[model samples]
Target: MAGSLPPLLLVGCGQMGGAMLAGWLADGLAPSVILDRHRDDIPAPHSVVRQASDLPDDFAPALIILATKPQKAAEILPSIAHFARHAPILSVMAGKTVGGLTAALAEAGTPGATVIRAMPNTPSAVGQGMTVCFAPPTATEADRALCTRLLSAVGDVAWVADEAQMDAVTAVSGSGPAYVFLLAELMEQAGIAQGLPADLARRIARRTVSGAGALMEQSGIDAAELRRRVTSPGGTTQQALEVLMAPQAWPATMEQAIAAATRRARELAS
Candidate 1:
């Protein structure tokens, strides 16, 4: 276990929040006081409360993590602002900007709260996640370090100086996993179409995608270089690459997809 994490107050335990909690537990973080309207999914041993008003009067958390759904932020922020006054706020809700969070906290009576925005992928459940965060000027070095340590439990942590870059971050790592999954799904369907048994197609597609990703990571090689090494001048791999890399194909489509996601993120923040 890394040194004990500051006393933590977690505001939600759904999908992404639950993944981060699982990672924290795996890393030996002490149980946190969790606040959620629905408590069935919360694991045993960590204290759970249904409402902020139910918290003991003397309770104080050193870090408060906001993981509620973006739509729920308006309703939940007021309940947590007491904790926000004394602790740095780490938020993983998609499209909730730091300025917006700060304003919510202020409305709850904790003015100028130090708010940090983070975007983490679903892979965090398996300890292979990518997390990018942007902190306001009010956040101190210690505050940033604490946030990094918390995020590192699930996977890698990156800090961006410009909060505006967060929209791009959301489009990339935050939504990248779904794109990879779609590729795997399409590959399996293609294999089945080519006369392979359904089970065999599924197994091969999953293994090939996972193995290639692992190899790329372990070898520290660029993806394009790795792809090149596998393609011979007249090989099947080269033929497939030529089709996929056409001007109107994957390269162009991927850029358009990311742009669409980035625009949605900006719209949500507004």
Candidate 2:
């Protein structure tokens, strides 16, 4: 609750959108209205208009949060085209530039709509997310600040001056969850290959990743410090680190993966 947050409007209520809604509700933000083609997932006691075509004439939302898939933005825009001309638009669609959103909003009639585009990671579902955003050049400073505060309701939000950096942001945070999940999967498989019981392998992998993450979060120290603390000269941990960080190793592989994702993001934007 940033004191004077706009009357909320949620466009897509999928996982990311649902997580945001949960955060808002937990923070006691009862949106003026919510819209989603599907409505089975939201909690009880919500007031949703449900359809764009049937929008109530008297209703006016101060901020419209577009949380739909990047590919679906065009399809979703016309549904709320009327709001494009009035409300400041806050978007969380990856690879979508601010100018593109403004154009969409202009087509909907909100020629001067203040637009903010953001790339948010999956951790927002638990308030541990990393989010980056960029505002249109025409956006007023006050509007940008309001957008930041609005996004902060869910998790950590940082502003980006360059919209071109958004694809890199998408590669880093937007695709980061999947990368971590893949690491967990590979860790479990490795444990199983080491002859541990399947159940034990799964359990150990889950706990190790979770505990390491928790320690990193709880401690104010940097991750490098924590990693060094676990390493000892000529010890087992050192041996593992050597293999993982060597010239031809996981770090390089991860960089390649990130680059590939970055390229794909650029392609999507194009």
Candidate 3:
């Protein structure tokens, strides 16, 4: 029980929530309550309910996780404000700021509630997530540590003091997995176009992407250095890199993409 996560009240069980839940379950979580409409197959020691109203009256979770869609925050925050009085609220809703969520909870009768914000991607489902968190001044060191403990059960964890940076974090890491998957997709398509069999193309493309990621992590090498290692002068890899790394190619496109995503995140918060 020493290493186990404390009891939690998870407000949603959609893609992101479900992914974190899977990691917590695999590690060791205390008896928790999941408030979700579409989920039903949790094992013993945990319970699932369709709505917050159905939560057990005597149950008191150590932390309340608000993983609902950002659009539903206004509707969901008030319902869970009572719980916030007893426990810090950890919100995983995209584009929802700590101040905004805290204001909503206050309007619902719980003022000065400690609210922490986190951006976690879908890779959490595989226990390889990258979660970035931001906590307000009201949150205690213990609150931050609790969040790190719970989130790290899934993958790596980092924190930022400036809440404004969360928008860029959202653009880079929160939406980063899709970018990687897109790379794999393009590689597979290119392989097929080059006369490789479809099945082999898919397999090699996926493995190459995953393997490269693993190598980067395990070797702790700079990605540019790794690229240099792979790209011999005028070789096939160099030829491809030359095209991909052109001024108007991936470099510029990626910058524009992340800028667009960051702007959108800011817009959502507003």
Candidate 4:
């Protein structure tokens, strides 16, 4: 609620963090303190104090949301670890691992910060994002519930018990939005091939993808059902589907791509 006590300290107010912040404000939960080196881009919320050397003199937060770049997190952790040590941390960085953060924080004498690795995609900016979270084994029921409620403001949230699967989460949902945009790109090119004007092709292609996505959101049915609805038997949509779903087509290639990203996730963590 707007006037209610805050539970979080957000570090790095970039795109992903901004998405989460927008979600929280929309849901009526605002962070008590938000810290970022540059505060220009964030929308001003009256209650959130964007920059202060330390957290407020009030009760310490139970959670800290980290949305900084992976490369910058290691550099920033030591300075900010004090506020985090007493709180569970949720990180949205793509490749950084909690272990590295833990070690870095420990060096600052700020130990015992529980880390929850989260991967959220760009769609979160519009409240239709998919967020996958992997919390430590010691994470309690209350902790999970708190995070689930906080993150749900952005979009749907799922939990993975094994942290090892988080890399795959990053590979899939984390990097998945760009793939959809890539589809739009190819669709535009296809329209150009069909002899439409370049600008018109671009508009049509963008609208087609956007409309399909909106339809999926409004319809309660699973994607398969929706596909079937559009794909009449022996029709144009069906023909396109046949090629798109082929063994060596987009599906298989996507699987391989996601796997590669997962491997890269592991490498980054190491």
- Per-model TM against the reference: 0.95, 0.91, 0.98, 0.87
Which residue pairs show collisions in model 1? Answer: none
Candidate 2's error at 191, in angstroms?
Answer: 1.2
Root-mean-square deviation of Cα positions for candidate 4 versus the true structure, in angstroms? 2.7
Residue 56 Cα positional deviation in candidate 1, in Å, after optimal superposition: 3.7
lDDT per residue (tens digit) for residues 101-174 in model 1: 89888988999899999999888888899999998888999999999988888899999999889899999999
Q: What is the lDDT of residue 14 in candidate 2?
A: 82
Q: Following a full C-alpha superposition, what root-mean-square deviation does model 2 have from the true structure?
A: 2.2
lDDT for each of the candidates?
Answer: 0.87, 0.79, 0.93, 0.79
Q: Is candidate 1 or candidate 2 better by TM-score?
A: 1
Across residues 103-184, which tens digit of lDDT does each residue of candidate 3 receive? Answer: 8999999999999999999899889999999999989999999999999999999999999999999999999999999999
Candidate 3 accuracy as lDDT: 0.93
Clashes of each: 0, 1, 0, 0
| Reference-based lDDT, residue 151, model 2 | 71
- List CA RMSD, all candidates: 1.6, 2.2, 1.2, 2.7
User: Pairing residues by index, what is the TM-score of model 3?
Assistant: 0.98
Off by more than 4 A, model 2: 1-6
Candidate 2 worst ten-residue window by lDDT: 1-10
